[model samples]
Target: MSAHIHAQNKTTEMERNVLLIEEQGSFAVGGKRIVKDGNFDLTNPLQPDGQTYHGDHAYVFYQVPPKARKYPLFFLHGAGQSKKTWETTADGREGFQNIFLRKGFGVYLLDQPRRGEAGRSTVEETIKATPDEQFWFTQFRIGNYPDYFPNVQFPKDEASLAQFYRQMTPNTGAFDGKVITDAVSQLFDKIGEGILVTHSQGGGPGWFTAIKNDKVKAVVAYEPYSSFVFPEGELPEPIQSTGLFGALKGVEIPLSDFEKLTKIPIVVYYGDNIAKEPTQVWNKDHWRSGLEMARLWAKAVNKHGGDATVIHLPEIGIHGNTHFPFSDLNNREVADHLAAWLREKSLD
Candidate 1:
């Protein structure tokens, strides 16, 4: 049967009775306590006062099916997003969380430090109201401002677009790779062995977490941004960017630490509308560098005997996908592809 038909059948089976959750809950991990020294006055609410605060943690919401697979999937969202990215899609369809749950896999969705439920931070950062929705719409490859790509898989209705824009959030603290990876490693320690699934900016921390923790059995990254990590001496030259986009640079790690990733299977996926060559357009330019860097990163991994694969959806006959393919209208097809990969890798 064709993949589309197979996906539809799976959806029907899921809605009927397959999606049975035996356990579900939430937790916070890897935070530190801070004590402030001052005098407190009840009469002056705004006056300086001594207090204790706990912050800089990662929050997780998990659901386990009745007969879950051996390895759970821990999902980490990209920058300016939260666990919501794995929940309901903008078009009101079931997101990857439910789809994978129906496939009998435990799903752990995360809200990284200083975002969403984990918004409290050790250091403060101001969040200004930036009117950049249109910019992001294009950056995400849905289309240029006020227009979507022809026959894009994204929901084109106005309401769907509005919902998509509303999902973007601001961080309460500055982005810190160490902080994120530390918390994620702690989470892996708590959860035991599982697959690390990351999107965009989360990919950097995802790699570091795997290096820091032995519990990461595999990795699945979706359109990871500019944070590909390499062994210290094997680092590739930074991919230069055009216009306002910053240069894409590979992060460095000790050769021994980098080899840890080789013990597990790794796959990186990219969506459509990425330029094949250099471009002056900001959105296209940014992703072009990202794509190039991903290939180089994969090559380096394989050179060290690591199993790594890079896939571009359009090259494989899947078309019109945006940056958020996991939440796109054809998401079931996308999920099915991942399911097959998991099975092939014996992770399911």
Candidate 2:
């Protein structure tokens, strides 16, 4: 189906899905029968029944119109964010969700386990307090101290900044990439095949998903920390060895397994000002370095008989976009290009 054919729909439909795995094995106090009150009550009231499932629930917003793309688009948000990041832009404009829906792709916006509505899991140990506004203000490239990224696209007014800060969900506990990977793998298995879209730290789980599951037809990764997958000197380690570096699940698969991705079409997008280092301000050189490594990885993928493309927005004259371009001022334009790329790949 042509991408252009999708806009004819006047309304979009959406469904919220919760994917969970039944908890197995014995709990500390569960299974022990205790006689309490006038009747028998299980030792653990939480699990009065035999077995309880850990809520490694992946909360997904599945949205689409009557006419949609053949492959669904799964969007994974970056660290310190929930699925809300994809629902609306920071400036209160429609986000990637609506853009892709209009273009006819069934969009699945995922709140990975432990974030947003997925809630905390029983297996998780502790939940960290949400950072202060200043932390996110600096971390998200909204500003460094009182200064913003040069020509930064993030809304600069006090009201807008406050609104942006509200979008942040508390940093839950440490995430088990294995759990997330398993959840994503299961979702893909249920859906059969679809395109994966990831941003920032989300790229970790995204990479693991694509490598382990053949159902991932393509990936549109927006700035996955390159060091996670293609680290310097030695190759990146397995998930079990590194824990969940970059918020991805650990798996038995080694970095060498990335070659399997040759069968999966992939595109990595980097935003503007990545190389900017203005004296005392925060140096964004890491972003540039990561993109460079991503470029090498893409080259290696192509060499190994797979196709991967790395795009630096500035190089294409699409500048002034922040790390979160999908929520930036040029979001629609960016989404349009992304849809175009999918259509070009014949996956739309």
Candidate 3:
């Protein structure tokens, strides 16, 4: 069936089978306790008080399906997003969380430190009420604000756009890569072996988590934003930006630590609308640099006998996908593609 037809028939006449799960629960991991020392006046409403706070943790919600697969998928979201990114689509369709669960795979969704349910932080940062929704709309490649790209897989209705906008979240503290990776690695320790799935900014910490914890058996990243890591002393020249997004510099890890990535099968995916070459447009340039870096990263991995593949959806005849293909109108098709890859790699 054509992509369009598949999208149009997303909801079928036959009812979806009720999902059966063997286990479901939530947990928080990796936190530090901070003590604020001061004399407390219980009778005074406004008095300096001594208190101990637990902060800097990641929140995870998980479900293990009946007869679950050998490995679970741990989903980490990007900047300005939370675990909700993998739950339900802007159009109200089932998102990747349910999609993968139906395939008998356990799914773990994370709200990284300082974001969403994990908002408690040891350090404080002011969150300004920014009017940047339009900028994000363009950056996400749904289209320039107020206009949807031709035949884009995103839901174009006003309500759906509003829902998407509401999903955007602010960090209560600074985005520290080490903090995120530490928490994720701790999560892996608790969950045991699993596949790490990352989207956009989450890809950076996801990589470090894999290196930090051997429990990460495989990695699947989607449009990883500007966080490619390279071996020490082998870092490539920074990819200069064409617009406001700064130059893309590869992070360097110790060669010994870098080899940990090679032990797992890795796949990177990009959607449509990203320019093949550098462009003055900031939105397109953002992804152009990402695509270019993905290729170079995969090459370096393969050079070290690592298995890595980069997939541009359009190049594979799947078109109109934006940055969030896993929640797009044709998300089932995208999930099918991933399922096929997992089977091919003997990961499923």
Candidate 4:
């Protein structure tokens, strides 16, 4: 059942079945050593149990068509989410995976290290706690009980909300920039050249990955909370420059790196109601600032000779979209919009 069968087209003769390749592996760095216990009760003398290998576990699922597009698309989910984010919409409609597959592009979905199928890592030692569902409910902009967005698209009933919550994985609020960047870099090493589609927290690591790996042709970030741009000489406020920038671990992106982004196109998408009236209960408090910073960053990238543009969906007549657009009810329409943009860039 993992392999889906479809009718082949006469002209291109693409294979009828959707070939799904599932790969599960761990990328290990550092070394292993043997440690002795004070009470020497060694049942197994050859035990190499003490090891310091901290790296990412990748659950990469590739959906490939016979006549695939020139470049594959890699989907990276944001914090506390899994590769499932790209597979299906919240209302149970198709997601970007099938949409892109129909467009002749292969898709690679990743369960980030220490998440989903990637499971546990020693890095969890650094994490003290995980946020509750209410935190996600408000932060993800789904709703805040009685004060939900006027035209909220997120499923509001208890059953649907429970399903959405199931997609939420436990994550240490702390993210090690180096570890994530390294893992994404490794992914690029495997895929060579492709496009990166990142959501929410995935934005920071996505940018870092594209910069570190020249094989990255473009990036499409949807509500990436981490900002990538700042004034040249001015230090950015925390959210603006607080996260990973390129390969520089846990530091603000340097002005010089702006030039590097010119090699590829960058498009950032922000859903409607970001700062509009009947404001999202959480917008004024948290989301709007990072978005403003993203706009400023986009301006900086364009000025520095990079192809970067930020799109506010509402301005373009696309309305009622939430932070997670790909999973919204009008996801296919949104996908079409992005596909058109990608074609304009000669990426489709």
Query: Which segments of model 4 are wrong by more than 4 Å?
Result: 1-54, 126-131, 172-174, 230-251, 276-281
User: What ranking of all candidate models by TM-score puts the best one first?
Assistant: 3, 1, 4, 2
Backbone N/Cα/C clashes per model: 0, 6, 0, 0
- Poorly placed runs, candidate 1 (over 4 Å): 1-12, 37-50
Give lDDT tens digits, candidate 2, residues 73-183: 888888878888888776788888777766667778788887777775645456556557775565455546578877777777777777777887754556667667777
CA lDDT, candidate 1, residue 27: 94
Query: On a 0 to 100 scale, what is the lDDT of residue 79 in model 3?
Result: 91
Candidate 1, 1-348: lDDT as tens digits: 697587667656875675778999999998778876886667875754676788999999999986568999999999889999998999899999998998878999999999999998999899899788888898898987777888689987899999998888889999898899989989989989999999999999999998999899999999998678899989898999772568888999899999998889999999888888988777777888999999999999999999999999899988888999899988988998999999899998
- Candidate 2 stretches with Cα past 4 Å from truth are 1-51, 128-131, 226-256, 276-283
Instruction: Arrange candidates, best lDDT first.
Output: 3, 1, 4, 2
Model 2 reaches what TM-score against the true structure?
A: 0.78
User: CA RMSD for every model?
Assistant: 3.7, 8.0, 4.9, 6.2
Q: Per-residue lDDT for 202-276 in model 4, tens only?
A: 888788887788889999999876546443574444542222231121235666665667779999998865654
Root-mean-square deviation of candidate 1: 3.7
- lDDT of each residue in 283-311, candidate 3, tens digit only: 78888888988999999998998999999
Candidate 4 lDDT trough over 10 residues, lowest sum: 241-250
lDDT of 3: 0.90
Worst 10 residues of 1 by lDDT: 7-16
TM-score winner, 2 or 3: 3
